[model samples]
Target: MDIEIIAIGGYEEAGRNMTAVRCGRDIVIFDMGLRLDQTTLNEDADIVGMQVADLVKIKAIPDDSVLKANDGTVKAIVCSHGHIDHIGAIPMLAQRYNAPIIATPYTTELIRQQMAGDTKAGDAAKLMALKAGQRYTLSQNLILEFVRTQHSIIDAVTPVLHTPEGAIVYALDFKLDRTPVIGEPPDVARLRQIGKEGVLALIVECTNVGKKGRCPSERIARDLVRDTITTYEDDKNAIIVSTFSSHVSRIKTIAECAHEIGRKPVLLGRSMEKYATIAEQMKLVSFPETTSAFGNRRTIDRTLRRIMKGGKDQFLPIVTGHQGEPGSVLTRIATGDTPYQLMQGDKVIFSANIIPTPLNFGQRHLIEARMQLVGARVFEDLHVSGHAYREDHYEFIQFLQPEHVIPAHGGMTMTAEYILFAGEMGYTPHATAHLMKNGQRVKIR
Candidate 1:
C-alpha cells in the first residue's frame, strides 16, 4: 500500500487546520477548521450563511478543492477537539464529503450545535461519538483509535490510524502534562507502546517549537489564578477576568477561586455560555453553585445591570474578549458600550496571552488604553500556553519514534524550527523530517 500525507491548510498558517492522509484509494480527512483572524476581519461577517467558495477566497476556511485531483474516497472526517480553529469549518466543508464526522462526545455535541442552522451540512453529515481510549473500525485496512491526551480544552485526543504499513499518529494540538486540571494526563504508557509497535509517519504540531523548555502545566495556571484572585478576598473593588471560553479547566479554576474569595462567578457572553453550558450539560465539568451564565446580548446586558445593581464587588465576571476582539464583553466594558461600568480601582485580569497577530496586538493595546482611561487596574498574562514547547516536542518524539516527521499547525518559521529540533534527534530535513505548506503532499512509502 502506498501512503501519502497531504497538508491542506494549517501548514502555511497557524489556523484553518486540515490534513488528509491517503492510503491507496482510502483517504481520511482530519480537522476541517477555520482561520479566526481572517474570519473576524469583518465583525458583521455572516459566516453561517456564507458559501464555502467565498470563505475560501477570503482565506477563512481550508480550500479543500485541492482534494479533487487526489484520487481517493474520503473515509471519515476526524476532529481533534471543539476549538473553533479545529472544528469551526464543519458547517461549511463537511457536507461536501459523504463521511461521518467522528469526534469525542463533547466535541460531537459542539459539532451538532455548529451544524444546526446549516441545512446542507446538517442534512449531509452524520455525527459520531468516539471516546478516548476507544477504537473505531473505518475499514478492513484502517482502524482509528483515539489516544487520551491533554490540552487547553477537555476531551482532547491524538488520533492514531492503524494501517497495514504502520500506525499513522496525528498529534496536532496536545500537551504532555502529568497533572491536568480536568482530565487524565496524556496516555504516555499507550503512546510508548505504540512507539514500540512501529509508527510509520507522525504528523505533529509545531506552534510552540521555538520556545525552549516544557510548557507549564495547567496546575501551575490554576495556582497562579488562585493566588491572584485570593489576594483581593477582602477588597471592595470589582474584579473581572477575560480568557478563552473553550478552556473549561481554566474557567473552572477561575470560578472556584471566585467562590473562594466570597464572590459569585458570573460567566458572560455567547461563547462563554455556549462552551460552559455544553460541558456542564454533558456532565464533564461543574462550576460553583453561585455561578450563573448569560449568552444572548439582551440577557447578558440584563445580567450586567443586575451585577451593577447588586454591587460590582459581589461578583467576578469571567467573560470573552481576551484578544480584544470587537464587540466582546471585555471590549464593550472597556469602551463603555455595556451597562457594566468600569470604575476607578476596578480590576481587569487577562488570563490569556495575545494570540500573536498584528490585529490582536493593536486591539489589545486599544482596549488596555481604554481600561486605563477608566482608571481600571489591568493585570495581564495570568495564564500558560496550551501548545507544547521545544522540550515537550522532544519528549513527544521520544514517545513516537516514527519513520517520517511532518511538522504542522504553524507557518514556515514554526515548521522550520521543528525541523531544526528534529535534526537534533538525528532526523534529516525532507528525508526523515518534512516541512510542508498549504496544498502540498509528501509520500512516506
Candidate 2:
C-alpha cells in the first residue's frame, strides 16, 4: 500500500489550513480555510470579484495548483470545525474539485451561510452534513469516520480515514477539555479503540505545543467571567465583553453571567449574529428571553440607542472584534464612531487573547489606548486557549500511538516544538515523526 501526504497550507503558518492525502489514485482534502490576517489586509481589494488567480497572487486562499495535476482523484473535502481559519475558504476553493464538502451540522450550516453571501462561488458548491461518530464510505478502498472532539467551537470532530493499508487519523484543531461548558468531552474511548486497531499514521495540530501543562478548561473561563462581573455589584456602568464570535460556549457563559448579575445580554456585530444564530438554530445553546441580537448597522444603531435609553448599566453588550478589527463594533464604540459612549469606570472585559500577529497586536493596542483615554477600565486575558498544550499533546500521543506522526496547524517554531516533543517521546525524526513543509509531499508505505 502506498500513501502520499501533501501539505497545501497550514504548515508554514496558522491559517489557510488545507492538506491532501492520497492513497493510490484516490485523494481526500481536509480543511479549506483562509489566512485571516492576509484576508483582512486585502479586504479593500474586492476579493469577492477578484479572479481565483488574483486571490492566489495575494495569498488570500490556498494555491491548489498541485491538486490540478490529479484533478478527478479528490473524493471528499472534510472540514474539521466551524472556525474561519478552518472553513472560511470553502466558498473560494471547494468548487474546484467535484466532491462533496463533508462536515458536521454546525460546520455545514456555517459553510452554507458563507456561500450564500458570495455570488461568485456559492452557486456551484455542494455540501454534505455528517454528524460526529458516524461513518461514511467514500469508496471501496476508503471509509471516513468522525470522532467528536472538544474545541472552542461547537461540533468539532477528528476524522479517521480507514483505508486498506490501515487507519489514518486527522487530529487537527482539538483540545481535551473534560469539563467543557457545552458539548461532550473528547471521545477518548474511540481514539483508544482506533489505536488498538493500529493507526498507520497520525496528523495532529501543534498550535500550543510550546506551552507547558494542559490548557485550562472552558469552565474555568466561565468562573472567571462570573467572578469579574459580580465584582461590579451595583456599579451601574456599561459592561462590554469581547470574544471570538465562533465561541458559542463562551457566549453562553457570558450571557448567563450577565443575567445572574441582573443585566440583560445583547449580541452585536455581524459575525456575533451569524454564529449565535447558527448555534440557536441547532439548539446547541439558547439565550435568555431578555437577550437581544442584531446584525445590520442600522439595527445595531437602533439597539444601542434603546440600550442606552434603558440604562447601559442594566445591559451587557457582547460583541465581536476580539482582535480589534478596524470596523468591528468594539472598535467603533471605542473610537467614538457610534451613538453609545464609554463613560468613566465602565468595564470592558476582553475574554480573548491577541492572536500574536503584528496587525492584531497593533490594533488591539490602539483600541485599548482609546478606551483608556475615555476613562474606561479594560481587562484582558480572562480566558484559556482552545488548543492542546504540551501535556495534552503527550496524552494524545500516548492514546493514539501511530506508527508515524506528522505535526500540523502551526508555524515553524511551533511545529519544531512538536518535533522535539515527539523526539522526547521516543519517535525518531524522518522515520517516525515527519516534519513536512507547505506544498511538500512525503510518501509512506
Candidate 3:
C-alpha cells in the first residue's frame, strides 16, 4: 500500500488550509482556504485581474506548486465547510487544478457567489454540490464520503476518503455540539462505523487544543443573547450586535431573540447578507418575515437613517466586523462613517472573540475605544467557538482509533499542545502522532 499526505499550508500558520493526499496515481486536495490576516490587510485593487503570482507574494492563498506538479493526477478538490479559512481561496486557486470542486450545498453556493464576484474566477471554477452523508466515487480506487458535522457555519462536513490503502478522515474546524441551535448534531455514528471498518490516518484540527474542556454548545450562546437582550430591552438607546457573518446558527438566534423582545431585526453588511441569503435559499435557517437585510452602502445608510428617525430602540441591527475589519459596518458605525450615531448608554454587543492576532488586537482596541468615547456600553466575549477543545479531541481520537494521526489547522505551539494531549491518549510522537509542517510530506506504507 502506498499513501502520501502533503501539508500544502495551514501547518505553520493558523489559516490558509490546504492538504493533498495521494493514493497511487489519484490525488485529491482538501480545503483551499485563505489567511485572513494577510487577505484582510492587503486590499486587492482588482481581485479579478490579480494573478496567482501576486497572491503568492502576499501569501493570501496557499502555494500549490506541489499539487500543480501533478497536473491531471488530481481527481477532486473537496471542501469541508463554507468558512473563509476553509473555502476562501477557492476563487483564487481552484482554477489551477483540472479536477471538479466538490462541496456541500451551502458551501457550493458560497463558492458560486465568490466566483460571481470575480469575472476571472467565474469562468474558472467548476463546482459540483454533494449533500452530506452521500458517497461519490472519484475514481475506481477512490471514494469520497462526507459526514455531516456541527460547526459555526451551515452545512459543514467531514470528508472521509476511502482509498485502497485504507480510510482517511479529514476532520477540521468542527465541534461535537449535541445541542446545536439550527443544524443536526455531529454524526458520531458514522464516524464510529468508519473506525470499526478501519482508518489509515486521521488529519484533525488543533485550533482549540490549548483549551482544556469541551467547547460550549451554541445553545449556551443563544441563552446568553436572550438574557442580555431581555435585560436591555427597556433601554431607550439603540442595540447593535456583531458576530461572524458565516455563523448562520448564531445569526438566527440573535434574530429570534430580537424579534421576541419586540424589536425589528436588521442585518447590515455585505457579508451578513451574502451568507444569510444563501442559508435562506438552502432552507437551512429561517429568519422571521420581518427581518431585513441591507447589503450595500447606499441601502445601509438609508436604513440607518430611517432607524435614527424612528426610535433606535425599536430596531436591533446585526452587522459585520467581529474581527474589527477596517471597512466593515461595525467599524464604520463606530467611526461615524454611517448616518446613525452611537449615543451614550447605547448597547453594542460583540458576539465574537478577538482572534488574538496583533492586527486584530489593535483594530479591536481602536473600535472599542471609539465606542467608549461615545459612551456606548460594550458587551464582549458572548460567543462560543466552533472548533473542538482538548477534551473533544480526546473523545474523537478514542472513537476513531486510527492507525496514525496528523494534527492540522494550527501553528507550531497549538499543534504541540495537541501532540501533548494525544500523548495522554497513548499516541506516541513520530510513531502514531505525526507533527507536520507546511510543504512537508509523509508516506504511509
Candidate 4:
C-alpha cells in the first residue's frame, strides 16, 4: 500500500493543525485545528463553520480539499488532544467527512464543548470516547490503538494506526510526565510492544524538540510557583495570575498554592470557567470550597468591590491573557477596561512563557511595559512545558524505531532540529527523517 501525508497548517507553525494520511485510497485524518491568534478575531460561525481560509491568512484550518479528494475514503478522524492547535478545526472539517472521531474522555469533552459553544453547534461531529489502551478498527486495513500521553491537559494520547504493512505512530505534543495526576503514565508498555512489532513511520511533534534536556516536571513547576508567589506574591495585596486556560493541572497547582497561602481563589475569564467546569464534572480536578468563579461584568464588578473594600489580600484572582491578548480579562483588568481597579503594589503572576511569535512578543512586551508603568510587580516563566525536549524525543525515537520519521509540529529550524535527533540514531539520512512544511506531502511505502 502507498501512503501519502499532507503537512497541513500546523506543520509550518505552532497552530492551525491539519494532517492527512492516505493508504491506497483509504485516508485517516490526524487533527484539524486553528491558529489561536487568528481565531481570536473570528466569531463562532467563523470558528466552527466552513473550511476557513483565504480570508484569515494567519490561520490554516486543515486541508479539507485533500480530505474531500479521498472521495469517502476517510476511515476515521483521531484528535490527539484538546488543545485548540490540535482540535480547533474539527467542527469545520468534520462536517465534510462522515467519520467517527476517536479520542480520550477528557478530550472528548473538550471537542463536545467546542462544538456546543460554537454557533454551528458542531453537530456534524460523530464522536467515540476512547480510553488509552483501547483498540479500534478504522477499516480492514487500519487497526488503531490509543497510547496515553502526558501534556498540560489531561487525556492526551499518541495514536498508533496499525496497518497490514506496519504501524504508524502519531506522537504529537507529548511530555513524558511520570507523575501526571490526571491519567496513567505514558503507555510505555505498548510503545515497547510497538517497537517489537516494528513501526513503519513515526510522526513526532517537534514543538519543543530543539531544547536539549528533558522538560522539567509539573512538580518543578509547582515549586516554581511556590518560589515565585511566596517571594513576589503580595499576601498584603490582591494577587492576579494568568496562564493557559486549558491547563487544568497547572490550574490545580496554582489553586493549591493559593489555598496554602490563605488566598480565596477566583477564576476569571471565559476559558478559565469553561475548562474548570469540565474538569470538575469529569472529576479530573477539584478546587477548594473557598474558590469562586466569576464571568459576567456585573458579577466581577461586585466581587472586585468586595475585594477592594475588604482587603486586597482577601482574594486571589486567576485570569486569562498570558500572551497579552488585548481584550482578555487580565489585560482589561490591567488596562482598566474592566471595572476592577488595581491598587499600587498589586502583583500579577504570569505562569506562562510568552509564546515566541512576533505578534505575541510585541503584545506581551507592550503589556508588561504598561504594567511596569503602573508599578505592578510581574513574575513570569514560572511554568513548565507540556512537550518533550530533544533528549526526551531521542528516547521516543529509540523506543519506536519506525522505518520512517517525520517532524510534524514546528518551523523549519525547529523541525530540522527535531528530525536531526532521529539522524543521530542508526537510521540513514533518507530512510529516517522527513521535515515537512504546510501543503507539502511525503510518500511512504
Candidate 5:
C-alpha cells in the first residue's frame, strides 16, 4: 500500500490548517480549521450559523470538497490544538465525515463546546478525547499517537501516525518551549525515540520559519506582563488588557499579576469567558480568586458598569479585541460604546501580536489610535509567539530525520522559504522536501 499526503488547506495561508495523510484505503485528517482573515468579517466574527458552502466561498473555512472526491474512508479527524485556526471549521464540516474527532482533553472540550453551539453538526460527529502520550488504533494499518508539545495554548500536542511503512508526524502549531508556564516541556525523549524508530514523512508548520531564532518561552511573556503591570501597581487609573482568549497561560499570568497588584481580574467578552472558564473548569489552570468573568453583551456591559462604579483602580479588565475586532470588549470600550470609561493615563495593554493580516493591522491601528485619542497609554507586544522559529524548525527536522518533508501551514513565500532552508540541509525539492499548495496532493512511496 502506498502513502499519499494531501494539502487540503493552510498551504495557501497561515490559517485554515487542514491536511490528510492517506494510507491505502484509510485516511487520517489533521485539523479542519478556519481562516481567521476573512475580509468580510472581523477578527471576532462568528461563522457558526453560516453554511459550509458560504464559508468556503469566503475562504473562512477549508473547502473539503476535494476530500469528497477521494475513494478512501476518513478514519479519524484529529486536531492538534484548540485554536480557531486548528478546529474552528469543525462545527460546519466535521458532520460530513463519518469518523471520530480525536483531540487532547482540553481541545476535545473546546470542540464539544463548538459542536454544542451548532446543532446541525453536533449530532452527526463523534468526539473522542485522546491525551498526550497515549495511542489509539484507527485501523489495522494505522495507529495514532499524541506527543506532548508546547504552544501558546495548553494541551497542544504533535500527533503521529504509525503505519506499516513508518511513522508520519504532524507538527503544525507547535513550539519547542523548554520552559512553558503551564505544562511540562515538549516530550524531548519521546520525540528522539520516534526519530530513532524511523519517520517516513514529516508534515510541519512554516509559520515562523522566517524568524531567525527559536521562539521564546511562555515564561518570558509572564515576565513581560508582570514587569509592565507591576510598574503601575500604585496607579489609580484603569488597566485594560487584551489577549488571545484561548491562551490560558497568559491569562493566568495576567490574572495573577492583577491580583498581586490589588486589582480584580475581570474577564470580559464571550470568548474571554468561554476559554478561560473552560480551562478553569477542567482544572487545567487556576486563576486568582479575585478573577471574575462575564460573557454576553448585557452581562458584560453590566459588569463594566460595576467596575466603573467600584472604581477603576480596584479592577483589571482582561478583555478580547487585541486585534481590534468589531464588537469585542476592547473595541466597544475604546469607542465609548461600553459603560467602562477610559480616563486619561488609563492603560490598555496588548498581550498579543497582530496576526499579520491587512484586516488585523488596520483594525489594530484604528483602535489604538482611538484609545490614544482618549489619552490612554497603550502597551504592546507583551507576548511570545507559539509557533516554532527557524532554529527550532531546524532542530525539529534534525530530531525527526524523516525521509520526506512537506512544508505546510503557510502561504507561498513561507512554504518556499522552508523548502530553501531544507535545501541547505540536503533535501531536494519535490523529491524529498515538497512544497505544496491548497488542494494539492503528492504521493510518497
Candidate 6:
C-alpha cells in the first residue's frame, strides 16, 4: 500500500487549492479551487465569464499534469468545504475524471450554485450529501470519513482517508470552535483515535500560523455585534454593515443584536441572500422577519428610497463590498447611485478586515473616501478571523500527534513562517513535512 499527495496550486500560494490523495490505482482529489490575483486575473476583469482556458493562461488554476497518471482513475472527489478558493475550480476539473463528489448538504448546494451557468460540464458531477462522522467507501483501496468542524461557514469537514498503508487526515479549513454559530465542534475524539491508530500525515490549514492566541469563538463575534448594537442604540441613524457572505454565525449575531436594539435587519447583497437560502436549508441560521432584500443597484436604490420614505429610522442593512469591490451594493450606495441619500450621520460597519493586500487596501481607502464624502460614519474591522492562530495550531498538532504535518492555504512566506511554529513546538522530522508546489507530489508508504 502507498500514499501520494499532489500539492497542486495553493500548496505554495494563496489560491487554486487542489490536492490529490492516491492509494494504488484508486485516487481522490480534495478541493479543486481558484487563486484570486488581480495582476494575474486582470483588475476590472470578472471571473463569471472566465472559463478554464482563461484560468490556465493566468495560472490561476492548478496544472492538470499532476493528475495525468491518475486521470481516469479517480474514484471519488471529496469536497472539503465550499469556499471558492477551495471549490472554485471544480466545474472545470470535476468532469475530466469520473467521480461522485461527496460533501455536506450546504456545501453541495453551494457548489451547485457556483456552477449555475456552466451548463456544458456542471451536469457531469454526481454530488452525494455526506453527514458528519459518516464513513463511505469509494473503492477497494480508498474509504472516506467526514468529520465535522467549525469554520466561518456551515458544514465544513475534515476528510479522513483510510488507506492500506495508514490513515491520512485532511484538516483542510478548520478551527476549534466549541461554540460555533452553525455546527458542532471538530471531532477531537475521532482524530485522537486516528492518531493512536497511526496517521501517515495530516494536512492542516496554515493561514494564520504566526498570529497568536486561539480564534475567538463565532459566539464572540456575535457578542461583538451585540455590543456594537448596544453602543449605538441611542442613535437614530440607519445602520449598514458588510461581511463575508458565508459567515452565517456573524450574520446571526448581527441579527440578534439588531433585534435587541429594536431594528429590522435587511440583508442586501446577492451572494449574501443566495447563501442565506442555503444556510436556512441546512438549518445553520434563519433569517429574521421584516428584513428587506436587494442585490442589484437599481433594486437597492428602490429599496432604500422606500425605507427612507417610510421613515424607517432604525434599520440594519447588510451588504457586500467590504473588500472594496466597486460594483457591490455598499459602494454603489455610498457613491450616491441609490435614490435615497444618507445625510449627517448614517452608520456603515465593516465586519471584516482588509486582508492586507495592497490592492484591497487601496480599494478600501477609495470606499472609505466615498462614504466620508457622503457624510456616512464608517466603522471597520469589527471582527475576528475564522482560522486557528499560532497557539491553536500547536494545540491541534499536540492533539493529532501525526508523524508529519504539511501546512497549507498560504504562500511561501506563510509556509516558511509555519515552519518556525513547528520548530518551537518540537515538530522535528521536518523532512516528513514536505514543502511542495503545484504539480509536485510526495510519496508516503
- Candidate 4 residue 157 Cα shift, in angstroms, is 0.8
lDDT of 6: 0.77
lDDT of 2 by residue, 278-361 (tens): 899889889887887898889888888888899998899998777888888898899988889899999999999898988889
lDDT digits (tens) for residues 1-445 of candidate 4: 8877767767777777778788888888898777766555421123544434552454556555544563348888899998887887776667667678888888899888777766654563488888888999888788889988898887788988998778999988799888775667788878988998999898888888878789888778888887766665435866889988888888887887788888888888777877887888888788888888776667766777787788778778888789888767777787777657776687888998888877888878887877778788888898999999888888887788788888877777878777677777765555567878787788887
What TM-score do all the candidates reach, one by one? 0.98, 0.97, 0.97, 0.93, 0.98, 0.94
Candidate 3 to native Cα RMSD, angstroms? 1.8
RMSD values for the candidates in order, in angstroms, are 1.4, 1.7, 1.8, 2.5, 1.2, 2.2
Model 1 TM-score, 2 decimals: 0.98
The whole-model lDDT of each prediction reads: 0.90, 0.87, 0.87, 0.78, 0.91, 0.77
Q: Which of candidates 5 and 6 is the stronger one according to lDDT?
A: 5
Taking all chains together, the TM-score of candidate 4 against the true structure is 0.93
How many residue pairs clash in each candidate at the backbone level? 0, 0, 0, 1, 0, 2
lDDT of 3 by residue, 1-445 (tens): 5798899989988888999998887899999987778766422112566777887778777888866564348899999998877887888888767789999999999888888877666453478999988999999999999998999998999999998777999998799999999888989999999998899999999999999899999999998888898765357888899998888899998999889888899998888888998899878889988899998889999999999998898899999887778888999999999999999999999999999888999999999999999899999988999999988998898778899889999899988888888888888998888899888888876
Off by over 4 Å in 2: 41-47, 122-125
Candidate 6, residues 81-197: lDDT per residue as tens digits? 888778777777777777798888888897786677466455634888888889998888778998878887788889988887778888878888888866688888887788788
RMSD of 1: 1.4
Between candidates 1 and 2, the lDDT winner: 1
Considering summed lDDT, which 10 consecutive residues are worst modelled in model 2?
Answer: 41-50
Q: Which stretches of model 4 miss by more than 4 angstroms?
A: 38-58, 68-72, 121-125, 230-234
lDDT of 1 by residue, 1-445 (tens): 9999989989988889999999999999999988889777422123677778888998889989889745689999999988877888899998888899999999999889878856657563489999999999998799999999999999999999999999999997998899999989999999999999999999999999999999999999999988889986469889999999999999999999999888999999888998899999999999999999988789989999998999998999999889999988899899989899998999999999998889999999999999999799999999999999999999998998999999999889999999999999899998989999899989998
